[model samples]
Target: MATQTLHRGRLIDHLQLVVNDLESSRRFYAAVFDVLGVPIGGSGEDYFWADELFVSSAASRAAQGALTGRHHLAFQARDRAMVDAFHRAALAHGGRDNGAPGERAYHPGYYAAFVLDPDGNNIEAVHHGDADRSAASVEISF
Candidate 1:
């Protein structure tokens, strides 16, 4: 994958996961993203974020309600190796194996792995085989 490639995410603008334990969630995400070559954009006492996903404690101001139910979040991976690494990192950092890394019948060349995050959300890292993109990602400036 090119260093400039953007892992195009799905339709959601931003998704917040209110977890029971913020630290565990943070560690879990940190590791997973690290292997996928994404960084934790920023963090607060009750939350940590990356690109379009945010994980927060129930007490955070942005985390307006009780803990959320299980959500299926699929992140784009550059290849099958990255998806495998994602599973290993998640499991090593407090996640549970939901599904092993392998090809799926969802479509041709769809390789993915699934893990249950600290909060039991179904998190996935997938590589939709080789493809091309027009731009890396959408950039915003303040």
Candidate 2:
């Protein structure tokens, strides 16, 4: 028998979201992601910057847009075109557009799109290609 190597799939391993309220945020994400809430552990007042878990300052709360909990988590698209596909699927899945597919000049080769997952948390699908990478290479081989 010959030894063979295994290939690990490429996908999100873990994510972190910063939210205004924990419980409320969990509810929103649950509905959006279509998954039950799973406790992430560590509950108490130490979760926030000022150690005030109950009170979200007016500025912070307002900036959160819709949901009070975690804002956004991004995933890599399988390819450049998949970014658009994800955007369309997201919209069909009740996601609102935050950003459309385009190059982010600030970040080199940053190609991505942003969508709000029913709860106003920004969900993104991105493909980081070279800054100069363009779709112009696509030509009919025939």
Candidate 3:
């Protein structure tokens, strides 16, 4: 495949969302991000985590009256500590706990957690790792 040409400007480093219902998404993302411990991107329609990612919400007509499958997203943590932090903060921010932090034997070394946002979107924070005899690996695929 040929490499695409680059544009002269600030490249799309990341994205921010404007949801129909910010409160709902807020709760959902809170729990999810907390487990990941990335931090809220900002306040109001905004969520903040670390310094690189920024998330803010807004009322979207496009998001209303239609159900779409576009809210699924994931974050790669530096280590298990970040994952654990995500889980904790998410719960505090109004997100419900979908799953606790743990290992998955199905994938060579999958460590992950799950949660449902206010909009009923499935969100997750996952870490890829190896299955060694010393660790208690469990099946997490659904």
Tens digits of per-residue lDDT, candidate 1, 1-142, equal 4233233444667788999988888889989999999888888888888988988888888878588878999998999999999999999999999999999999999999999998899999999999998766765443
Q: Judging by lDDT against the true structure, name the best candidate.
A: 1
Screening candidate 2 with a backbone cut-off below 3 angstroms (N, C-alpha, C), the clashing residue pairs are: 19-69, 19-70
Once fitted onto the true fold, the runs of candidate 1 whose alpha carbons sit more than 4 angstroms away are 1-10
* Candidate 3 local lDDT, 102-121, one digit each (tens): 88675766777766655555
- How high a TM-score does candidate 1 get? 0.90
Model 3 per-residue lDDT at 139: 24
> What local distance difference test score does each model get?
0.88, 0.52, 0.55
Backbone clashes, candidate 2 = 2
Runs of candidate 3 exceeding 4 Å displacement: 1-18, 23-71, 130-142
Error of 3 at 74 (Å): 1.7
Model 1, poorest ten-residue lDDT window? 1-10
List the candidates' TM-scores in order.
0.90, 0.47, 0.53
Q: Which window of ten consecutive residues has the lowest lDDT sum in model 3?
A: 4-13
lDDT of 1 at 48: 87
Which candidate gets the maximum TM-score versus the true structure? 1
